[model samples]
Target: MGFLDISHVTKSYGQVQVLHEVDIAVQEGEFLVLVGPSGCGKSTLLNMIAGLEAISSGDIAIKGRVINGVHPSKRNIAMVFQSYALYPNMTVGQNMTFGLEMHGVPKPARDAALADVAKLLQIDHLLDRKPGQLSGGQRQRVAMGRALVRNPDVFLFDEPLSNLDAKLRVDMRTEIKKLHQKLKTTIVYVTHDQIEAMTLSTRIAVMNKGYVQQLGTPKEIYDTPANLFVATFMGSPAMNILPATVVMEGGQPHAEITDADGARRLLRFSQGNLAEWADKPILLGIRPEAITDPEGADRKSANIQPLANRVTVTEPAGSDTFVTMTLSGKDVIARMRADAMVAPGEVFDFAINMDKAVAFDPATEARIPQ
Candidate 1:
């Protein structure tokens, strides 16, 4: 039996459906991330699992027991909300122990739990201070510490790191991962940030418009997205999707892309199970890294073709430079080495890693090969 099972769970507020028969199974100690844009029902799903929101239909089970109708406190789950939700007047230590105090836990046990969690979160010295006295990151750690004190069957995080600044968010992301590793607890985390989902999740459920678009490991979701929504949503620079038509050239399939300058290019993919997409309009999906400068040693062994395009915009961020160009009448960004020198309006040649490109049906938006 799965440790946490949300079986065909659905929720609606009046006539507006927020979650459409969402289903997810989390293994024991698995870190599952539910990620999507705001109002996509990721947090609603998390709330349902936390028992904060009532399920419109279907069931939720934890540790092989149904908890659909259980109260929030009785579900043996700890939830850390985005707002921190800390007691304003209480010190950090008191906030961390408030739940245990209400549960009638002895002072010794509460103190021990506070000491252990404070040390684990590196907030031991700040325990005597109130939430107002700490930084955003420190308050987040206190919120997490409050959750950790319970050692509940499941931990629900509703964008717990969203309140922090970028640098602190990254730091807390690492802290959460380390805490998960040390505690070996089942965690269901909700967030709108794709990078957070990619970095922290054992499996990610990409939600959109009250439905789950895809659920898979970070690599799987990035390399082989379920549909157009997922492909466009999960990546940082976003996957470069261009409208193209599939044509059979010399008994093989090829994606023909027409550049903004009216120049035409043919990209050939491996032919095996793509016979059905012949002579049809399709969307070609390619990551920015796949189309890069061909100076690397790995480019020699790869089947890539050089395409020349004039750069419209160049953004350098120390490590890599992002160059944007017009391709197939759409803006496409490519990541190149920062040392590579190319200015705006200057044409540069890049090799497209055609083997990594994916094709999607234009009408249905599903992957073509599968």
Candidate 2:
């Protein structure tokens, strides 16, 4: 058994069901991130774990004890909300200790606990100020400090950094990682940002339409997605998926795509045993990084095929450049170094690292077993 287990959990609001039979087992000190787009029911599942929302069926167990019907406060799980849910009327110090005071803790004990958390979060000076008097980043620290004072079994962060600006979010992400490292506590964080999920979690659960699409380490999810939805959702630009037909060339498996000019291109994948799949239509998934300029090809890849393709769009994003081209009548994105001289309406030999390619069955939208 894991430290926290959600066994076949489901949730509904009267007749409207929102969460399916979702099961997540979180180990002690594991940082699990539940990430998806808006209204994806990630928050609903989190609420169930926190006892803020009722589950229609199934069990939620913490440390081997069922907590499905436990009170939120009694769950011993502290939550940090997106809005930095601090009391505007109270000073940061008061906000940090309010929960303990309400629970009948003595002032001395609460103050001691608050002092420790304040020091840990480096917000001692801001403790006398109210939430309104602090910056967005500082208020977030206070909210986290409030939760830390409780010293709960699990930390539930419901998009805690969502309110901060991009730069602050990045900084806070690093801080949260460091805090987790020092505390070694289990964390279940929810976010809509794939980048946050990638950077923060030990494992990420990508959800969609109330169901968990895939759950794996960030690298596992990014390198080998379970399905098409996951392949397209977890990455920054997402994996480029194109329809192609499997063909055999010189007794080897190859993915064939016909260009707009009737020219057929062959992409040899690293995985073998494609004899049966030949002549069958399949979806090819490739990340932008896997397709680059000749000089930009990943040195570790065993196979890098160069295609003379015309660039339809060229977008320079700081350190990297993204170029769009057509393959099999589908737009494909390739990542290149910022210095790569790529321009629209120009035909260039693009290096594609097929060794990192993934194949999916179009009908089921599931990755083909390699």
Candidate 3:
């Protein structure tokens, strides 16, 4: 059995529903990330699992036992919220031991727990200091330390790193991943940040409008998204969805797209099991990394179909560069190596790696075979 099972879980407030018949099975020691945009009910689902919010319908089971009616304190689960939720008046030591104290744990046992957690989190020196004196990252660690001290069955993180700055957030994300590896604990994390989800999760559930759009590993979600929403939401520069028509060329599927000069190009997809979608009205989804400048020697093997287009803008972000160009009357972003020597208003020959391209049906918004 799965470590935690959310069976047809639903949540509603008064007359409105926030979570709709969601089901997720979390394996032991697995890091599962629930990710989506604001108002998508990711946090609501996490809260329900933590017992902070009641489930409007369905059942939640941990280790094959129903926990639907269990009180938060008796659930054997620990939560780390975005706000840190540290007590201003208490020292870090006291904050970490508070839950144990309430549970009637002996003083000697509680002290040992605090010592172990402090050492694990690398915050032993700050145990005597109050939350007010610690930096944002330090305080976040203390909050996590508090949860770690509990030695609970599962850990629920509700955007725990959201309050930190970008650099600190990245640092803390690495710390959390290392911590989880050491502890081998089951974790369910909720966040709207796609980068966090992609980097930290063993599996990710892409949520939208109170429903799960797709659940898969990061590579599966990135390379083969289940639908258009997932295709657009998972990538950094976002997948470029171009309107195209599919036609059969020698019994194979080829996507026809109009380039900037009103010239038509047929990009063939001969990947595994793509013969089903021979001819259809589909949207071509391509990541920025899949498109490259043809003149670059590194992309010699990348099916260079030279498309003439004037670059509208160029953004250099250290390791890579992004160029914006108009294709089929829609703007498309291309990511290339930082050394790519292309300037604005320059017409360049671009090549797309059609082997990695994806196709989605226009009507159902679902991925097609080709």
lDDT of 2 by residue, 1-370 (tens): 8999999998888887788899899999999999999988999999999999988999999999999889999999999998988999999999999999988999999999999999999999998898999999999999999999998999999999989999998999999999999999999999999999999999999999899999899998998899999999988787899888999888888999887889999988777876689999999999999989999899988999888989999999999999999998888998899999898999999999988899999899999978
* lDDT of the structure predicted as candidate 2: 0.92
Residue 328's lDDT within candidate 2 is: 81
lDDT tens digits, residues 89-125, model 1?
9999999999999999999999999999899888999
Model 3 error, position 205 (Å): 0.6
lDDT of 1: 0.89
| TM-score, prediction 1 | 0.96
The list of candidate 2 runs beyond 4 A from truth reads none
Stretches > 4 Å off in candidate 1:
297-301
Q: What order do you get sorting by TM-score, best first? A: 2, 1, 3
lDDT of 3 by residue, 1-370 (tens): 5899999999999999989999899999999999999999999999999998999999999999899999999999999989999989999999999999999999999999999999988999999999999999999999999999999999999999989999999999999999988889999999999999999999999999999999999999889999999999998999999998777778766888877677887887756355566555789998998888875434434444456678999999999999999888899999988989889999987777886788898999999854
Per-model TM values vs. the true structure: 0.96, 0.98, 0.95
- The deviation in Å at residue 38 for candidate 2 is 1.4
* Each model's lDDT: 0.89, 0.92, 0.90
